[model samples]
Target: MPNTQRLLTARNIWMATVRPNGTPHLVPIWFIWINERIYICTAPESIKARNLRANPNVSVSLEDGNNPLVVECTAKLLDKPFPDEVVRLFKSKFDWNILTDDEYGALFEFTPVKWLLG
Candidate 1:
């Protein structure tokens, strides 16, 4: 297991999704790390969302290029009415209320299966 302290303190993470054609699509995103899992918000129609729907395998890493902490995870989209605790964490960490935003798309919960800290 990765050091929870380090993972939680990181400001940003890079999420990697596989395109339909097998290319890697990566983007920086805001995330909440709780209970050893990572939660991220993205548009339902966005490329990352679409890619994850097609393939659940994903990789996330801290933005520190000098000392990378990478994790391999499986992502699943949560149905309507996301967990209240998750919503609260997002609000507290990002100061963004996902619950009240109609523009926000889907919320994805990622469970880590592997870790690589360098």
Candidate 2:
């Protein structure tokens, strides 16, 4: 597998969340890794955001098909006035300012509880 830190720099990671009725909601989205925690921004009304409100348990996987890295995490919705470091990371990685983006108003912080690497 690629270096964990390097893999995190990839443009998109697939996230899986559970719907209220028990089905899975999965999508590929931009993310940042800071201090071993994963952070993603999405629209407040997005499906993933709604699902996360109902259930915080989530699964995230890097895009590599041959050598995969998956993380099992418990996610939390971050309050406004987001951290400066998180803002900087997103700016440098995506060239988009999270603080200025109204479309992506909600931020989710994912803390890894278990990791699967192969």
Q: What tens digits encode model 2's per-residue C-alpha lDDT throughout 1-118?
A: 2257755568899999999999999999999998878999999999999999899999999898877889899999999899999999999989989999999999999998988763
Given candidate 1, what's the lDDT at residue 109?
95
* Candidate 1 lDDT over residue span 1-118, tens digit each: 6566876667689999999999999999989988878999988899999999999999999888887789999999999789889999888888999988766668999999988774
- CA shift at 91, candidate 2, in angstroms? 0.4
Once fitted onto the true fold, the runs of candidate 1 whose alpha carbons sit more than 4 angstroms away are: none
Q: What is the lDDT of residue 28 in candidate 2?
A: 99
Worst 10 residues of 1 by lDDT: 1-10
Q: State each candidate's clash count.
A: 0, 0
Clashes of 2: 0
Q: Against the hidden reference, what TM-scores do the models get?
A: 0.94, 0.94
| Deviation of model 2 at 81, angstroms | 0.9
Give the Å shift of residue 4 in candidate 1: 2.2
lDDT of 2: 0.90
